[model samples]
Target: MPDPAGQPPPSSHTLWRAFVPRWAYMPLSGEGAARFGGRWNPVGQPTIYAARELSTAWAEYNQGFVQHPALIAQLRLDAARLVDLTDPAELDARRIDPSIHACEWRDAMDRGKVPETHRLRKRLMGEGADGVIYPSFMSPGGTCVALWRWNAPGALRLTVVDPDHRLPKTQASWV
Candidate 1:
């Protein structure tokens, strides 16, 4: 759920990757730089730096950065966002592949009834936030539909993996 301001809760422990142009390093200012000092000493003009966590001061570092060889990084667990799945009903009405809502699909599979164009397979939930929304192993991009095969006996625990909004298959066009 979003905070009172309708924004994802502020993160304290999530790791962040900031791609700093060689020219921008000296000017970069944040608690991490103040505490750890500039680790990227402007070697090749462009480099990725792993900031300690999300901070209002690091307002410029919201985008994902590509992996780099020389940069060291760590993820902050304190600021991790919990998956918001208070309503799985919404997904059920939308993204599930219409061809397989019943046991017939499974029965067909058992009988070697595979199709030529697209394969119909069992649904799977991912390990983290993407799982809450996508819940299918067949596709990595994610679908709005989920077949919740199992539930924890009393409570639910979800981990946050990415902050960006991933569109469900229903609302997104996939080629």
Candidate 2:
């Protein structure tokens, strides 16, 4: 990792996410979220969502409704540049109110208005942040990360946790 700004990353982190088995081969893909938009991203801006803990991942995926079988994955993030939205000091320094954590992005979108969360993401992104870590609404005390860029130059590296070639590589797995 080349440090152009001469600053090393704060640390490495591991995250967890659950997806449909058909999309297991493309765990890093954010096209689904892009098409529909999410709490952290507006429509057309792809974002990968992950949790700091496995239980939190399950909670996020289930969301109180019965869901189809899922493939839970452990993800690795290396030297990633992320802003912790849950940090009070950072929020105060950035002049952002903590109420954003409870933003009703979906309802706002349904009402044809841009969500505050979307605006927050745009601002942080423009400031060169790769992603954000915020307290999860689905899981109390749980933290989640929303990444827009990874595994590329001038960005961080993110990898799935398949060690023995267990996950299928071809798209045929989707069929």
TM-score of each: 0.19, 0.92
What is the TM-score (0 to 1) of candidate 2?
0.92
- Winning candidate number (TM-score): 2
Off by over 4 Å in 1: 16-68, 73-175
Candidate 1's TM-score reads: 0.19
Give a tens-digit lDDT track for model 1, residues 15-67.
34333333232222233433422221111222223333333113334322443
**Residue lDDT tens for model 2, 1-175:** 2135522234579999988788877889988899999999999988999999998898888886887588999999987778788888778767779999989999999999999999988887776778888998789999999998788786788999998979988779666
In candidate 2, which residue ranges exceed 4 Å CA deviation?
A: 1-10
Clashes of 2: 0
Candidate 1: C-alpha RMSD to true structure equals 19.6
